[model samples]
Target: MSSSSSAMLHTSPLRRYALLASNPPASTSYSTRAMAIELATLPLPASADASKFADFGREVKGVNLGSLTEEQLKEIQELLYKHDVLLFRDADVTPEQQFALTKAFDPTSAVYGHGNNKTGKTTLSILHPDLKTIPRVPQVQLIGNGMVYNHEGLAEAKLKHPHHKTFHKTHISDEDEEKGATRFYRWHIDAALYDLSPPKVTTLYGLSVPRGGKQVCRYDDGTGDELEVPLGTTAFVSGRTMFEILPPELKSLAVRSKVRYAPHPYVWMAPAHAKSTGLGIENEGLEMSFDDLPPWEQSKVKTFPILWKNPVTGGLHFQVHPCGVSELIVDPLPADAKKTGNELYPDGAHIKDLGAVRDILYKMQRPAIAPNLVYPHDWHEKDMVLFHNRGVLHTVVGAFKEDQVRAFHQCNLAASDDPIGPSEEDIKKWA
Candidate 1:
């Protein structure tokens, strides 16, 4: 027998078939046999259809981090990039496990401490006086209406700073301190005004969830109603979907423009006796002009693109925090212009129009409120949710009673440094 024929006769049936599949003989019948064998051996692709996953309040399932293998972890990572928000129902993960899962997705991200220094370790003892960090893990912030209260009732002893009053009063209703609405409720992405790059992923583990009356919300279609669900649910809007439906003119403007944000740390620096006020409403220090702010505060000004493209998913997202932005510069002139003394005007002067940028953002905000685009998560105890900050805008759904214990441990993944703008030409070409 020939050497090729001898080798084929000695090989296993599966191996022989696989080899033939790659190099089929001249006979059409052999080619057909090879194709059939090849098809039988190939692995199937994972499902990417969003509907197959859970929906709204309980979106996404089958995530058990405690028992996750390398392959399963990779699949979760892919789902996060694809779905933007994932609700791991009743995950019941411990602090260490949560930290490990976060590190897997972002190896370099440090557990974020609310008032930690630039390195995210050294504590700034003076900040967030009303909030307490978990002693075992300082990065986990204890947030809820009940944290400050005790058997003595609204334990004034725990509050040591003027801003503590602002924090304490925020969760209570103005009409009745005991039944007040949450003052911090506002649609926003975290840390937009800070000097560091904003966090890319945020995971919130619900340790305790309060069940109560329906939470009221206004819809984009000029309709308002109460959601027949538990209080303290976190509401989210898909920024990518919002950007996709924008008018072509606004879409182009967002890709080409940038927003200017200066430090407005009211949540971190509220005066000792200042009354708690809801975010997005008029509050102290929120209206100061850039020039009016102290030099140190003015130095916090950072410019960011209006439209940001996710590196992993290649998805385009509108990245404006309307409440956080101090100024909007549309079609801003280049920063490195060479001009004579008389020709050199201030950077603010070159802004095409002051309100123009905000007007365009408002257009985006309107569509974002539609029910189809928003997902309000009705959190269950031990439910861990991981969401991409680049693709979603989230806020507190409603107020929880002071007696209701609604605690959560929040961790953030490191921010991406890739320039934010329109999608890459290659990604666009494929689309």
Candidate 2:
């Protein structure tokens, strides 16, 4: 929002949540006067792995997400399905209260999962040069990085801010990126996979916060991994701790698989690239040729399900987004189950080989993006955050300074249902 941040939001006043009149500081915080909401977990990542994520994320103090109530929006959707990320530092939110707290976590949703000007008319989408539409809350998206003046209605924009040397595939030398070195610009899970649906939550907010100096993220995929982050940080990673640290035959190939995706999938992988550990595409066939994308519809493609469950921690998350996949299917092993060795496709298959579907989703989502199982987010000016778009797998890490302007205000919605897979006793207890 920038009309001098909407004129400093009328000289400050939206803080709310008083009545703590004493006694509330120990056992890692939490407060509730019928949801006056106070919470407090988010801190780990001094190279995290603190005994497996130490309860994902939380922070949220004195809640004024612009006056919530519906029992504080059902305890902020049960604290975002039990803390999959929620921070809110100094927030005063508004793009209509961050699209009504992201449509109150799917109250039958309302647009923008990639279709309100659809990444600005899909210029071969890879989110066409990173989002901007917020002309009075077009499901809130003003994103960050460069020029911005009247904002919210855009009378001058320019933004950008996504930089793994233009979608990665080996990059990290401009004297190791001017010595502050970075990477991780696209891990994903905001999902516009196809005919809209996957957005169970995602709020962001941080208006213009770009103070610099922390950079190092470089998992150049050779695994000398790196992580010191926080320059333009936003990292995160834990689809249920990437399905509880896999290896039960990749958690029974992630609850018996499903993926598919691809049609228009950001214009069929906007000419490929990723995977210097941004986790997915590096096949080099440089995509875009299902008869030249864009008019898709084998019944609007999609497919989904490599795990997902967790409606408040039934816990089975491994959610897949590996560069808009394109077929994996699987489904076999349950007869008496216990096969133990040589179990990969157990009997069923499908796959459609794009380097064997990015080598089985990079051997089951690369050890949950290790750098001690990441968290990264360090933004400040009125922060906000939220996340748990069906569990986690974020990205967009460091590098900014073409005069570093970085404003923020995101918000997610396109999900009037779809993402509840896995039960049949969670596929016979993980296939």
Candidate 3:
């Protein structure tokens, strides 16, 4: 974080010693990294339809979303609201198209997300499976962003993966260290650190997801099933497609292993963070155990997980990533209540006992469902799809990584005629 930004944030009301002694609101807002981890399937919107567009998987390359006619643009926007995501394969896009796509979704969003220093417009990453961008600097590419995984300009506490790669944990990497072809970023939400509404829809056009069989996974909640939608398919998520209602079994399995018992120092950061941001985000989220929660807390746990609705269409979407959630304290149930456990997906995920808890667990799993409707297209290299930012969630099966030479571009801009960012009122309603 810049000294100026830090000064602004800290100097704000949350810093008073008394407020700091207890819990504060700014901590609720600014405490964690970019994305909240230890996740449950976040929910989708209310108006979901899976089969609206038969041309969804069609692929086309080398063009700008800017070229579409005014009528076509309106149709695309409406389609996005109806289907969540629109897929155009083999898309060849220009910087202008990149900017236009941003405008289509959230005109208020920056044309160049977080600039080169933070979010990569044509960014780069090096996973062994795919090569996505030119020169291996991936901000140059855009992929299925059901959930925004990029942070804002630059914030010290932006929530991100423990490591850019699967196995490493040093929070600080200076620019000199990351100047090479391999650029790594954690899975997180766009504009999550500050009080910014997450970009409703993010796009990732795969130049090549490769046939090597290294399938990167995305969490599909409805059936608690893993969906391997092909590269050509743009996973549109909106109302009714929320991940909040995950499968009963899958929700428990994600954290059931040793991950459940591990004690992380970051857990200690909660009191400090929560004390500052009355937003109530506990820094010690992962440490709380299902068995240790208080009665009211347990009830909240028993209730459905947090889900988001697009303020624009009143549509729902599943926006949770497995690694981005926290555990809530739960209270033990009465003996009789415990006897009536859930009877679905009775896999290893559910033990012999804890039946009631199991029921609550089941409720936490958002059903893995597709957009009520989608604009299906054939996979081709000359096309690009655009949609409403506050409309749906999007995802894909291929890694589309920079190593594979996969290329795509994106730029965010305000859609309003007056040209102002998304209003804070809308962000509150949407996020």
Which candidate number maximizes lDDT? Answer: 2
Comparison by TM-score, 1 against 3, better one = 1
Query: Residue by residue across 1-431, what tens digits does model 2's lDDT show?
Result: 85644553453221111111112223323333444678878877588878776777888776655555456667777878887888888876557667656766765577878767678766878788788888756877888888988875789888888887788777888887787988887888997978888898888888879777888877876669898987888888889988888877788877888989888877878878888877888888988889987677798788988888878868878888888888888888888887877678888798898889888888888988889888888889988888888899898887787788988888888898789888888778777
If scored against the real structure, what TM-score would every candidate get?
A: 0.65, 0.32, 0.42
- Number of the predicted model whose TM-score against the real structure is largest: 1
Give the range of the ten consecutive residues with the poorest summed lDDT in model 2.
Answer: 14-23
Judged by lDDT against the true structure, how good is candidate 2? 0.79
What is the per-residue lDDT of model 3 for residues 315-380, given as tens digits with 9 covering 90 to 100? 433333222233322222222222225423222332323233323323343233332332222244
Ranking by lDDT: 2, 1, 3
Candidate 3 lands at a TM-score of 0.42
Off by over 4 Å in 2: 1-63, 66-70, 73-75, 82-169, 172-183, 186-205, 209-252, 256-274, 280-309, 313-315, 319-383, 405-424
Estimate every model's Cα lDDT from 0 to 1: 0.51, 0.79, 0.32
Looking at model 3, residue 39 earns an lDDT score of 15
Higher-TM-score candidate of 1 and 2? 1
